[model samples]
Target: MELNQVYFWTNTIKDWKRLLQPDKYKHVILQSWQELVSRGVVCIYGFVIMPNHLHIVWEMLEPNGKEIPHASFNKFTSHTILADLKQHHPQVLPFFSVDDSDRLHRVWQRDPLAILMDGQEKVEQKIEYMHRNPLHERWNLVDSPENYRWSSAPFYETGLDEWGILTHYKDRF
Candidate 1:
């Protein structure tokens, strides 16, 4: 399929607010995100990391000469996240069923919402909406989106980050 826009979303295995999960696992999710960008899978556009869920807007890249049915950044991260969660959070084991194929019902929800931004207007609008998500009606974590370190807002506003981060302020990483 031709590549353009992708919104990949996933939630915690049990909606357990592993939100307070130590910074240790922060890399688990972020590393997987960086890997995709590093491997030419997607040109990340925007993202937001809520306590139990995440939403990402990426411009899926179809590099020349690559052969694959599809390059789903979502699929790769889903597996990595499940693996990471299982390793770090085995307490939730009983909540899921493991199958012979190695797939487990570990995702809080099968899929949250992976809508494609089919046009420039929608893409721009989604980008803006995602940036302002932290400010939505009752979602008051901060007075401004840039105050949230887990989202791309700060990356754009202050250019401060710890590791591999591709944004308008990639130098922060």
Candidate 2:
């Protein structure tokens, strides 16, 4: 959440709804990252999008406007996902309805985990964990880390940025 510091960020869908199981929803997160990176507000070092949650190794370079980049990211992605669900999947929208006065539907759980990565060892540790997440027994999304399409593993393995949203962690740490 702090500027100029790398963080291992984890945000999950409300009540673990598996909202991101659809590729379109995952693209919503990806596009948000791409926009933030293009604007130089954040630099993504690593990431993985699971069925219900996502983990990112990223650094906030500057504020998006009056708010921190991560705040903007959460707000934007939430709104975007909400809009899509309202128009295309109204039946599924009720699952996210909340009793809060400020909002009706909440896509992301509040107060996501963001751990400061103060050293290369910590950063590397987080990235490797994220990369291996898809191969975990719970999800078994892919047989290998690099085979997972929604992660930075392939980028690190082949030096390719398919989403054009990653910065090699070494470039910063």
What are the TM-scores, per candidate, against the unseen true structure?
A: 0.66, 0.98
Top TM-score: which candidate number? Answer: 2
Q: Which runs in model 2 stand beyond 4 Å of their true positions?
A: none
* Per-residue C-alpha lDDT of model 1 across residues 57-143, encoded as one tens digit per residue: 665666523542123443554566567657987775555554537565554455456676655566566666767866777567678
Q: Tell me the whole-model lDDT of each prediction, alpha carbons only.
A: 0.58, 0.95
**Per-residue CA lDDT of candidate 2, range 45-128, in tens?**
999999999999999999998989999989999999999999999999999999999999999999999999999999999999
lDDT of 1: 0.58
Model 1 TM-score, 2 decimals: 0.66
